[model samples]
Target: MSTTIAPDRPARTGEAVPRATAGAVLGALMRQRLRRDRWQILIWLLCIALLAMFSASAIDQTYGDANARAQLIRLAIADPTIIVLRGLPQGTSLAAVAFFEIYTFLALLAGLMNTFLAVRHSRAEEESGRAELVGSTPAGRLLPTTATVLHAVAVNAALAVVTALGFIAAGLPAYGSFVAGAATAGAGFAFFAVGLLLAQLMNTSRGANGFAAAVVVLAYLVRGIGDAMGTPFGDGTHQRSAWPTWLSPIGWGEQFAPYTGDDWRPLLLQLGLAVLLIAAVFGLQAVRDSGAGLIPERAGRATARPALGGVFGLAWRLQWPTVLGWTIGGALGGLLAGALGTVINSSIADNPALSGIRDAIGRIGGGGSGPLTQLFISAIFSIIGVLAAACAVQTVIRLRQEEASGTAELVMSAPVTRTRWLFSYVAVGVIAVLAVLLAGAIASGLSAVAAGEGASTFGDSFAAAAAQVPVALVYLGVLTLVFVLVPSWTAPVGWAALGLGAFVGIFGGLVKLPEGVRHLSPFADAPVVVGDVDWTGGYWMLGITVVALAGAAALIRRRDFAIG
Candidate 1:
């Protein structure tokens, strides 16, 4: 009966289909963004919040007396270098002093966090071909960008709330704490706009991240210069910043003067800048193709250089620019160490009022019962150690990037063994470590002598730099092993480990973290050269580095190339 002939039916191809609304698409995209970044964003927020809480609590305990806080502010105002590294001294009140010692670092971390978040969702997705796939769907190109902006806004808003609560939990004034949180969010959002705009101009995620980070750093440096040159107020514990401070988003955060001024007007500058940059980013997206960059990459040479003949050579060729950048940073840290070391010593030498402040600064370098000058140099060198370790981490992470991009597969076709390939990158990391430390050592010594310090400080500078070598090497070796065992974890794990270690090591004591937890950071365990010259930690780290590298070399052969 069913076999009876039926009239042909239309294919129904012309029927309208339900299309997702822009708002629905936007929400979905935002959900995806949040899901991917929840852990990372949480970690960043926690760190920022912890910094605020710990600094407020610690400052209240250490400088409880108003006169003591007043002396600290006066010292910071007198030393331009202190002003360069810290914030504008608003007043001598406990809350104001806490703000002075901590705000610049908070702004710095926020700027970096926002820039990386911007690049990760934008250029990184395009590089993986996901952008084109999404573009072909109903979501389209621009909505994804809109979603990204909204995601960033949500994160920054959380940052503002988290930071405020952190301060208030530690007994800071509630209104001023919220004002400080708002200042942090405003500066972070402006940096986010900068990163999104740069993503449109760069050909790759790597280039975009590098340029955006450089801009953030440059803004910090410029603000420091302007603040350092400012005019001190009649109280001798406050300063009016110069014009150059107005040119930096970080500088704008300083203008908030949260505890003292409690002004909301500076927030307007941050919001206005963000609005303008985001508008420009949208305009660029409207005109440009999905996978292309506004600024085209330059052409390569017709023939390979002799240095490109080997795997190690190739790794060096790819990473030298990165190495150079970190080296310059080390030099700057060194210069400050030299220039400020003497100033720090002379100020703290016999001042009973500043003993607590002196102890606070000394704790950063894992303080020693040595000469005041040596303690100051060690503290500055600890900061330099951070730069070197960061360079090492980036070097190891580059291997993962190569594998994910399929470049490692092409290089493997040449009969190179997996272990050798891994080792080649490790060798480059070693050289980078040395280069950064050496630059720091040289700059520190020269600057110290130029600052009228004794020539003997040259030896101290070299020793301090040397003490940091094993600490950096440990990071390189441990992270290289992580790359081999779990390729996808390289970036997140590397950066997270660095941030945690630095926090625990540099500020752990200041924040009164548990002794056991503080001891776990490589930075905290670095050799102390000031007193009796302890090298026990350095020796242990060297052994650990060797073992880790050996483990990585053997295990790398078992895994196949990762898919993503």
Candidate 2:
């Protein structure tokens, strides 16, 4: 009976069978992703941790007296623009002021970290054809997305732990430190979900990243505008609008108000939103085809226009949206700076602690300008300059993307010379950086006028913004050289360079680094426009930029372009 084949037995179908369960596949993918992304995770965690600690420690170092701390808090609370930029002032304690000044920015940084992390592991993998390979195996369709999101969760969890430890080590209250770290992590997780959803919606990683970044910017602006427009009729209390804080994830985390009082409730909202978004991601992935997005891509012109025949025009066409986004962000930052500038002076002067802090910052670079002016301009423009440098590096890195996507080979196969092609993109990066800087200046100038600085002071605001351009150009040059020489390492090396420069430039005085090391930042050497104009330093930086460009142009002609 056993030897004879059973009459009811069916033949095998010969279809491929899965050998692993969903959990098994997910675990494998998670491990693989962690190994690949460990460096990025480490960098983001270290940056946020360092920033939190530094800000806290600096406040403790600068304002040891209780009365001066209270005075500084009162001044900060009274400034609507400051409230808008930094989120609502927390408690009157020095720790709360530190939280008020830096929590929003920390949230912003976390959002960025999550955005890049999620996009790279999801849409980027799909775009590069790795997702399809994984799909062909025992892995279920949702496994990859699930694994990526979980990886983000793990990374953010680590960020929270490290940040809490950093704050505590910096002498902040332990409970508030923990809450602040958790809030920051919550914001990051929310953006991580947003980025994942965006990856499913936008076909290309670049578009997904840009859209996600725009959301971060929009979140900040919405929170700012809401805080600034607080109802006048809400009694005599300093209670500004609290509703707007609920409208954004960043706001939700920031309004948790660490160190002031722990408001743990708003974090529930962030968690809920993240849950909703992650649920949507699974639904969208189930319906959409691999390597495709839920949102349909628009078809382009059937034939190339006359302007598109040139390298410059093509470069602009590809990167114009990126340029526009950075310009708008820079302009908004400048507007906040100018509006705050109008009030920050009297506020600082009235507070001894603030005045001393300002004077010390002034002494860092030869004490030529009024301390208040130097403090305001340096603080504002330095941030704008760092952001501009980021935009510049991104713009330059597009060259690498083109090469990897085979677009460079096609364009080079045409009658164009490599030198011309390379220069066109380099020119675009240079022009884009300058455009963003100018836009920031003009916007700041206009805001200054609106804030009663008068039309004459508009020129001063413009100079203040323009003075930051040399540092941005230095970043652009560094990135371009990296792209041409070590194409594989462009992003990490380029961004790391910019990050280090910004770190040293911003906190060098507070951290008490050697003067020579402090001046190593290109921005540090550039004259604070609120003080004196160092034409010699400016010319030197410009010359260095030129030299970098010359080297990149020469190198690209000889090296083989990378292909996917």
Candidate 3:
């Protein structure tokens, strides 16, 4: 017991120990990161492949014959909204149609996957103190950053290979498949670099993620507008050239027109932009001190306001940034919906090529004055409703996070009861969801009017946006039930429900699923406000949400608080 132990130190002999090379240090860090992130990487790769393959598989069934394929190309080229949502279709070939149908969205998915991955491996590790632990040893200063960039590269490369093979398996030409996959991967690489640069620039991981997500949203908006600008709407006789598409990195993939133009030049542009971003990331990283951001964080107020004394107000303060982010995104999405809604009629009015799509909307809406516009708005609102649910779920889940972090104990130890504390956050979440939905409605209404639609259309847009609130509440209710019943499964179950609902709602039409099966989605059951509103369905949904929240409150009072 009296024996003294000495720290492991280098020998005092005249000889110096050889230092580990940067490669060796980086290699070890990469190995550790791979082990930690292997499953996440696999799932991301699988999702990318599956999304691509699913989109490709639907092309044949959607357009059965050469004439159908030709019509699709014509309708797509004539519609600025189509080009805005999807990329420009360069040719009338089946390959071109498939590429156009899937690439824009797939590129978006790839970009998001890369962003999350880069942030997790770079800023999140630093935030959690893991990076410092690793750096305490013989590791070099740039090892962590280098490892993260390499991990992103490797994952994106795998995504490219998988996407190419998926296209080939779907019977696309090898050359086209390779080029499209490369373009997709190139888009991801550029965003991955963006995430890395943001990580160095923002003071917190949350800030980094928010900033990066904002950039992604901005890119999508710019590309959508630019693509919309590329075409003159009406009879498609007058064409206008626009440069915003060239300015957006996300727009570069569409410009490739993989199967049609087989243009490889856009890939070079993507790579060049990525290379410059990566270079800037390193330069920025080198100058910033460890655990500090390039931009200094501002100090907070020295005193809390009276409103902050209550749990409800505190919850709002903490979740406001997230709410703001979603609000901005929803506003932008609404703008797109409004712009498209305004032009939807002219785009499909006289085109025989678009008759089938028009007819489908007619069938879905039971044939009204503007059934197609209603269908489009309903679809947009459906997706937005799901996103609102997601945002609400994140907000409510902050309760569990607070509990796990031991902050809830401190708050509850005050005069607040468990019920008040729990419902306070839930109330804030409900308010946030409502605000976001309303914001989207207002933005859509204004944008539609601005886009030259009648001012009355704003009322329709607002009604459509508001009508989806019940469905979003349904999601909130379901997730709250999960949080109360099975705390650990809250995130997975909540997100899975949203994902499954969206998949069913979107793909049900493409796959020609049974009407009964399609109606299982809350969004499907919810009435589109463009026609008569289904008050019965909305009321039932609201009732269910109220019941779930009541039950959750009761349960929170009985159960022991969870800890990490």
Candidate 4:
């Protein structure tokens, strides 16, 4: 009964490979990514350069005058929100303040690009199955990750160079320009590492992306909180209390203090953190199996629940995660708004300069102070709702992707009709959008109540939050139509619509763009409730939304499933 060992079975070595060979393998992978993504690399570099230059030039035009610079400084000193949002410059020069004010936003964009690029090439490709094919060859396990990190570094370096040049061209001091550029690059690298870490932890690329984005948002919030709570350095209040700002990654970047102290230590701290994160990522990868995550994928229901039999149920299933994500984000945004409102109200009572700016904002929003504040909060929430709608639309398009990928076939083979299947996802998306809006409204209402505003004020705020629904629904409809009629390009088209709407609705006024262009955004037609609430626009938006949705349903019904 003794068993003989199989001749084909090789003895286990129980030893790891040489470090030098591992290094070479990683280097090769990095080279592969660089070579493959050169086009995207170039595009990112170009975009960053252009954006930095444009921002610098715009700032120069906006605050070049001494009077304007003085006025801005005065206002910022009085308003904590402005300082927190824009940051503080050391000098009166347009370039100095511009770099200070815009660097955070620019860094955010750069970080986003880096994170997306890193994950898109690494985890995203892995999830999509392309990585398996690549890995089956002579490629090392760590090669792709190494390559992605390298790519991120190269791109960020390019961004830094471009930003530095832009600042120099804008007449900023050379040292300050260097600090600003490096700070931006450093921030990007930090987030790139974060994305890598997330990619390793999440089972899906989408989950990784969402998690990474949530981290970025948290970093921003932390920085904002720190900035809002921080005392002026020279104001003799407490010198030891700079701890909050010191803890934030964004704050660390800001601590480079660009035209001011030009502190280089914070940049070193950021770089150190990035290196640690990358090292952690590698360590985690070493312990985990390829294509597996640190967190195990949870087992979903094998048998569909009775409630999942219909269109509505399917819709809920598909859209719930996205709806929840947006709801959380909106609530956080509302909280931020509430905090800012508190700051603004206090600032208005104390500083004439802030009061003037507040009055100006009020006029733009259409008059009364209270109404103006409500309108401002509403506008912000509306934007959040629109983002939620975009998420919903993407969720719908996910169904199309599933169909294309043949996953839908499995579901369709079950006791589900095409109409029910499609409607289920559509209904979920719509409900998710509404949920996000409601969450935002509730958050704002709570904030208003906390701020000692009247119950009517809470009602007004919630109403404004609700008002965004129709506009968001219109976008959802457009996406649904696209998802039904032309599934291939639905994502790009849907995202583009959201981007265009945001640009036209939010920035158009600031840029003094034409009314017709502004009106193209669904939000443009939304009534301003600064002084008074107008129900007419709400009715119109509702009607338009209904029409668009109906049109989408009709189109979806008429079209055959292209994948099937």
lDDT of 2 by residue, 3-95 (tens): 423224221222233434556667889999898777667776787787788777767776666665665555445556456656665555767
Q: What residue runs in model 4 are displaced by over 4 Å at the alpha carbon?
A: 1-54, 88-90, 162-179, 233-241, 260-264, 299-302, 335-343, 363-372, 379-383, 386-390, 393-406, 412-426, 474-526, 532-564
- How many pairs of residues in model 2 come into backbone collision? 0
- Model 2, residue 132: distance off in Å is 2.5
Cα deviation at 84, candidate 2, in Å, is 2.8
User: What Cα-based lDDT does every candidate model obtain?
Assistant: 0.86, 0.75, 0.72, 0.66
- Local error of candidate 3 at residue 258 (angstroms): 2.7
What are the per-model C-alpha RMSD values against the true structure?
5.4, 6.1, 5.1, 6.4
Models sorted by lDDT, best on top: 1, 2, 3, 4
Specify the highest-TM-score model's number.
Answer: 1
Q: Write the per-residue lDDT of candidate 4 for residues 24-93, one digit (tens) a residue.
A: 6677677777776676556556555555565566567666677776666665555555555555444556
Better of 1 and 2 by TM-score: 1
For candidate 1, the TM-score is 0.90
How many collisions per candidate? Answer: 0, 0, 0, 4
**lDDT score for residue 191 of model 1:** 99
Q: Model 4, 118: alpha-carbon shift in Å?
A: 3.2
Candidates by TM-score, descending order = 1, 2, 3, 4
Clashing pairs in 1: none
What TM-score goes with each of the models?
0.90, 0.84, 0.82, 0.78
Tens-digit lDDT track for model 1 on 486-560? 887787777767866876788777645667978989999999888778999999999999999999989988889
